[model samples]
Target: MRCKYPIYLLLSLIVLSCQRKDQVVKRDNEPDIHILQGEDTEMNTAIENAQKSLYKFKEAIESRNPDYYNFALKERFNTAGSGGEHIWISEVQYSDDKFYGIVDGDPISTTEVKLGDTIEINPHNITDWIYIDKNIVKGGYTTRVLRKRMSQKEREQMDKENGFTIENE
Candidate 1:
């Protein structure tokens, strides 16, 4: 996804576990962005966990809880040929058993959508969900996995730049 500041800043923070060597991209004007491999076991597990606990995000939205803010979902969009990239959609709304949200960042590998575009979310394509609670991040399973791959300095920089702390649970 296209990297921006603040919330979308996290969109570019992708890394694989140290056990595996993943391609890491360094930009002069942006944070290091890593491309995750689909075969990674840890990432797969994170996605599974995120899907299993998706109800929490849905419930929070349904309740209209003020404390729960910045609700988003990461969904995989297919490329023209094969494979797909997971992009985050923010300002999510659920109604009639369907989800709708705005694309939070620009596409890196897929041309199906772009930043700020409203689109219907397919439940099966959802890989992760997140919301902020009292300045702490909740249900960012994939994000946590990616963060674990960063160095201590990188993690600290991310925490400082993102304006939210993701606690280790």
Candidate 2:
């Protein structure tokens, strides 16, 4: 009886200490995996707005020949990734119901991101977007001249004032 009790105790301990090894789980109310679409709407709207804002800014810079240069938009996701201040998103585009971004000269087409390799995230993983504008400073150093997130309404107003139409196709 004592031996049986110790075996049961050890088995219980092992089971309690173990965690689910799968990245996804099947539930009665939830799916086996988290699909990117139909999960995040705010992020989708934010990205769309960011795209519009960038388009307007680029057009203005080109037409007016602004001194500012090297402007880009970046996004962060909820997926597991290394902690860093430098966000690596060069571009974001939609293909096959998922958003892909260029990070560090490579395209990220999946949810899991590799270490030191900036990649796009599933739409559901997106947390926020950053609009960055870098300008050449003294000593040939590029400084962040502008960094902020604009709301969809704000972008719309700016577009109207600049005589730009945001045509999403």
Candidate 3:
């Protein structure tokens, strides 16, 4: 029995170590925003133009064509005050004048946020809104699945160079 216990302990340790360290375990309530698989750096970017209306952003998300735009939302301050900016990876969905979406990936918050929870964003205090539209290559097109982080400027530059432009309002 003692020898069996030792073998079992060793097996458990090996199993735990084989698991990916970056795997994010979410709670039961939150929505599932499965942006990427496996370990990779989280996405973050600062939105340069605050004057733009949310309508533009809303339209993009609701269109349901964003198969390659993965992003992370960083917390911010506004009329809502602190703790309002719950940082999480999510894809926004607009319906009935309210933005609804799921947590796409792990969040930077200590609070318990599940993978498929509804996300709320104060239309005004949004920061770090960086993403890329679908990609088109020579003779064919491809979805933007590369887990690389890009700045707002870089994203815009890539858009223009690729002949794909996201309207700004």
Candidate 4:
């Protein structure tokens, strides 16, 4: 237990020491632009959540298999997956980029991605990549595949926005 205390102290110190201290470069005095591409984070949520809420809404209304869903939704389900192959989606247009948006807010974080920007998100892995559409959502991109690689500062920023805890690495 005595040795464990030293290791714990070391970890805590390591976590605290390397906070956000560096800065991005000044490009024409504007913030450095980061092009984020690939994978929708909200899609990682379970299909059943959408099925229960989204499709269910359309299904109940139309009395048929739901291929149509609402344009804005905020569903909380524990599926933790990119909704599988069988899901049909409504397109959310952000200038040109289309993302599978939830019923609540926009899908592609507009503040994050810009049009004509070449960004890469490894949906499956870093080596595996797909070209992000500046105006459309790729249907086959699974939530698991497009793993979000959040930078330290970005993660902290998102955590603050979402009111969640962030672990800095």
lDDT of 4 by residue, 1-169 (tens): 0111211111110000011222222245222322222242343332333333333232332432232222222222111233211111222222232223312212222233232232332112111111112211122122222123436685455444433221211
lDDT of 4: 0.24
By descending lDDT, how would the candidates be arranged? 1, 3, 2, 4
Q: How big is the positional error of residue 39 in model 2, measured in Å on the Cα after superposition? A: 1.9
Off by over 4 Å in 2: 1-38, 61-66, 73-102, 105-169
Clashes of 1: 0
Q: How much lDDT does each candidate structure score?
A: 0.77, 0.30, 0.34, 0.24
| lDDT, candidate 2, 1-169, per-residue tens | 0112211111110000012221233345321221223223443455455445544443533443434332233444333233211233434444454445554212123344442353444443332333222321111001111101335684454444433222221
Candidate 4: residue 62 Cα off by (Å): 24
Report the Cα lDDT for residue 142, model 2: 10
- lDDT score at residue 7, model 1, on the 0-100 scale: 62
TM-score per candidate, chains pooled = 0.86, 0.26, 0.37, 0.19
Give the Å error, residue 50, model 4. Answer: 11
For every model in order, what is the number of clashing pairs? 0, 0, 11, 13
Among these predictions, the greatest lDDT belongs to 1
The residue-level lDDT of candidate 1 at 73 comes to 93
Where is the poorest 10-residue window by lDDT in model 4?
8-17
